[model samples]
Target: MKHSGSILIVDDNPDILIAARLLLKQHYQRVKTTDNPFDIAGIINEQRNSDQPIDVILLDMNFSQDSISGKEGFYWLKKIIEQDANIVVLLMTAYGDIQLAVDAIKAGASDFIAKPWQNEQLLGAVAAAFSHAKDKQQVGKLTRQKQGLNQALNTPNFKFLGQSNAMQQVFSTIEKAAQTDANILITGESGTGKELTAHAIHQASMRHNQTFMSLDMGAVAQNLFESELFGHKKGAFTDAKADRIGKFELAQGGSLFLDELGNLPLEHQAKLLAALQNRQVTPIGGSKTIDIDIRLICATNDNLEQAVAEGRFRQDLLYRINTVEIRLPALREHSDDIPLLADYYLNHFAQKYKRNLTITTHDMASLCHYSWPGNVRELAHAIERAVILSEGENLDVSSVVGNITSNANSTNNPIENNNAYDTFDLDILEQRTVRAALTHYQGNVSHAAKALGLTRGAMYRRLEKYGL
Candidate 1:
């Protein structure tokens, strides 16, 4: 089924408002009616507060038969555009004032609708307005992505710096995904360079010159989710001091990187689904709906399938976002890349901390032996710490990675980790280990239980015993 956007009919005449609503009702999910020009602003504010934006405005040009200049309507239209430049405004004009209609267009009217309108013409104009809005949005999204990519590519930190087959495959994947507008879902443990991948994708796209904004979904508040994503009108809420634009609107011609997407609430999932489907957004407390043109790239450590099964996320939304899923291997799974990544980080830290440290064979072995639970992020931090704290030219392996290898060897089997299981004193050490791992990974039972060599469901039952 075709997605129907919301429409607003603004006319002083009740008959005209009724007619417009009836005509638009067939195409739009909602058709708001307002006869008073004075109440138009309030009506818009109401919609914005509700997180529903008015997609297209069918505004009557002339108000009060005594005032045929359309001065009031024109003034409001100008005000509306000043507030939101992307709104689709269709002017309604009486017959024989073709010059006025032309002037309205010049003054920011999207398209003019003649009085005593034909159904086809009105619908055609509305459809054209939607098309125009979408085109404008796409152009804006490209512009932003282009700016972000240019900045990222110009940075000295963008070199992939690897010779491994895994790294080679990642480079190839980045190159392939960059050339298209497909929605990308990147999954891996945190600190696995997902943001770097997103930036690389943006730089590789045709929109490398536009703005690229990244939003951390986990950081946003649940109650403020809609306002942050769609935007809000001034006076829409207590803290909505002015008309606020959402990420979708700001990312108008660029790529929108939604980091930690799995953490978003179900309410937000519905809103996100709507925006991606329609490519438009409404600000909080404001009546005008702005079009958005953005390539979306989402990243998360959480498994969305598990989220769906647990009813924490919507399945349909998952289908929409996972059009092109790229599962990134963790550092442990791709151990062959450790030496390469470590060398890159070592050199980076050595230069940054003004140290002349060199990695010895012993140092390399220590790094390769340890399991990096925190992935590339943990390794980078460890390297920086080592560089800052080391004294001589040769990197200090003992000081840098104290006990990392030793700890791994000792805890290779969860059942053998006497210290970790000491608190529980359980009859089943394996089950207790799985529960502890689940708790540590925050309900990511699969990943948590993986550390203990158990299946997800097995870990789930053990976690249940601990009242998790």
Candidate 2:
């Protein structure tokens, strides 16, 4: 018959405290009784400090013999609410004090019970109060979660642009997949707007207003993978300073976008697959497994089929993620969209840098003609560079396409050429590019990584590999 919550009873009569405590103790997990209503503040403070806060308070009116106004009860009721607005309060009054009890209820009391109350009525009232308190706590938790999500989504860059037939087909697929909870896997070359596609799906889904959290696998080190995805309790590890909520928990009741999925280690695939299969995750160094509800969307540039064949990736994990697959065409395949994309980038950069710049027909022709091996990302970077370096209102095509054409013509490999490296050796070119990016950003790893189209963790590994 015991309920889940604790209760506190305050009365001026010792007999009333003894009778109330004995009756309530049979139903509540913990029952505290006090004969002095003046000691209420101290008792509440002690409970608060102990972290075993009182859930409901049963306060009696008319503490003094001549006190029929119930002023003392009203004052204590206000004080209790001030101490903890969430705590449920029930005022106890005599039959003659019913009017005063009604006034107390109007002020702030959760409910009022006559002094000669039936046992069933008292139990039901206290149970209802306890339920109300729990509901308040849950609402507060969700409000904080929503605020955190809003702060995380402040980086407004979710534009999905492309009018080509391939892009049209991709959009069609996204529209169909957005209504359901099926797992989606987006496959495409780097900078082909895979993350943008994921965002589009999330926005179009029913959970659009909930949350859309993106986690880049390439940016997470292997050592910290479990903790990053499944969360960890305080003291779980040497560096776990506090209990942390993982991406799975944060994205609950919404969508979770796992970018660079191919970068996930083979050993960790089983762990991810298990969580997806069971719909639950266990935090590091924690025994409890928390249930999770989320729509999964994964993106990867790597050919997962080839990886599976080569034993570098698990086929089971791929099956779990690719229930619905969307493939994006590279920039070269959709060269017709170059003008639209170029104009978009031009306007974006112009607004960003607070400059007025126009793109000429000649510049458009040059951009369309070049085979963008780095895809849309490289083109955006080129436009940003032109916006920053150009002196006139018109964009400088020479500066924009000069090094691009030169590099493409100099190298035999188109991929290497698009990288803008003069050297033929790929390793030395990679090392040099990483070093240059780091230098350009003045040792800011995140900026350098973004400019180079690499994750921060990947850039760190490259820096260590080249001793930069």
Candidate 3:
């Protein structure tokens, strides 16, 4: 097999440098030998700029003719790590200096090789070091992502709003659970603020200063599930052109919210369960298993118990994720909070549209009396639409409740409104909803898809089917 990585060798002995370069070049893609250790940093910077950075460095322990202290080797090793902690360094030492080699390992050297080492042993050590370097690179990348996500979480938005008894209970539960590292499972209908609940928990937790990563399990395809959640190395499979840091690693020392957990395929549930149980993940085409430390928070609309009983979900996985369950009540169940939620959305959208609009008592009552099947999300959307389309200081009650009241009086189902759909055909309903989302977002496919909770690829397929 042809190994694919750049290797660097640094030694004072010309013979050792030549021999090491020749042997490594036969296995690795690129090999460079340097007799001076001071030039190491310059070479690495050049290679990094050229996008061919060395993956592993082989360094001799001694430089001066009669010196056996290995001090120079330790100094250069520290330099290499300081320059790029992702680059793995293997220290070369005499058999008599084995203790020094151990010290080098403790000082961050990947491994060590004694003089007169067998060729097979040298090659094995180099291969392992290369793998270590790649893993470190992935970790570094994840650390950067964690930093970026922390910045994003600092933005002011998405407050959890409610004063009802049901919502008060949810707030109390979140306050209690936020201090612990226990796994949490949030159950609620779609758009009922399950993800918001998860976000609130993360922001309140001891890890609030760390990263908060979220994934919608339902959006990922079955074939990409493992790679998306557990990560994959370069060349792990077709089209895996580069190394990827998965959600579990990115959210290390923080919280990871797995939404739509019930939609995860049954066949793939075992893999997820295994990772959670082991608290480690092995990337595809990688030999090293990485330990993960994360507070997992999962949300699902489906009744997991029913899914487990029907064999659609793994019982073991459900038990693992639901260590402490918090269920959010649907909007209809807590209708008393409708006026507060509606006014909040009204003020939010009014400001967004730069409109000095207000909601009349009649319109507010109309919003509260309607049974919002789509929960808080639908209410928000309706208020936004009213704010945009209203021509006066008062929001148009007709525009806010036209479809809802008409459909409710006819069939007791607000979703069956003529604007969204006149019939009960699922395809037509989907088409209308997709069209409406596209319109709402001004034809931005990504925003439309996200608003509908569909992946961009899925949204594109629907658009093509409907010829939109």
Top candidate on TM-score is 2
Taking the tens digit of each residue's C-alpha lDDT, what string does model 2 give over 1-468?
A: 578677899998888888888889998888898988778888888887988888899998778887777788888888888878888999987844556766977989888888887989998999899998899788888888875775468234736888998789999999999999999999887667888898889888888877788899877989899999999999998999999989999899989999988878888998999999999999998999999999999998777898899998999999999999999887889999999999998999999999999988877887887776557876887788889889988988667556444444445543334455446777657865775665454444555788999877787677555434
The residue-by-residue lDDT of candidate 1 on 1-468, one tens digit each, is 333666778888889988888878878787898876677667777877897766678888777776778787788898777766766899886742778888888999898877889999998999888888778778878867765665764343635444667667887887888899989898877656788788778878876777677888876878888887788888899988887778888777878899889888888899899988888877766666788899999998898899999998899999988788877766777788888887888888788877888888877887888766556766777777778878878877557455554345766434435465434446346544553564477444446767877765665565444223
Which residue pairs show backbone clashes in model 2?
none
What's model 3's overall lDDT? 0.83
Ranking by lDDT: 3, 2, 1
Instruction: Indicate the worst ten consecutive residues by lDDT in candidate 1.
Output: 459-468
TM-score of each: 0.59, 0.63, 0.60
Lowest lDDT block of 10, candidate 2: 413-422
Off by over 4 Å in 1: 1-161, 406-468
lDDT of candidate 3 at residue 410, scale 0 to 100: 53
Per-prediction count of colliding residue pairs? 30, 0, 0
Q: Which candidate's lDDT is highest?
A: 3
Ranking by TM-score: 2, 3, 1
List the RMSD of every prediction in angstroms.
17.5, 13.0, 12.1
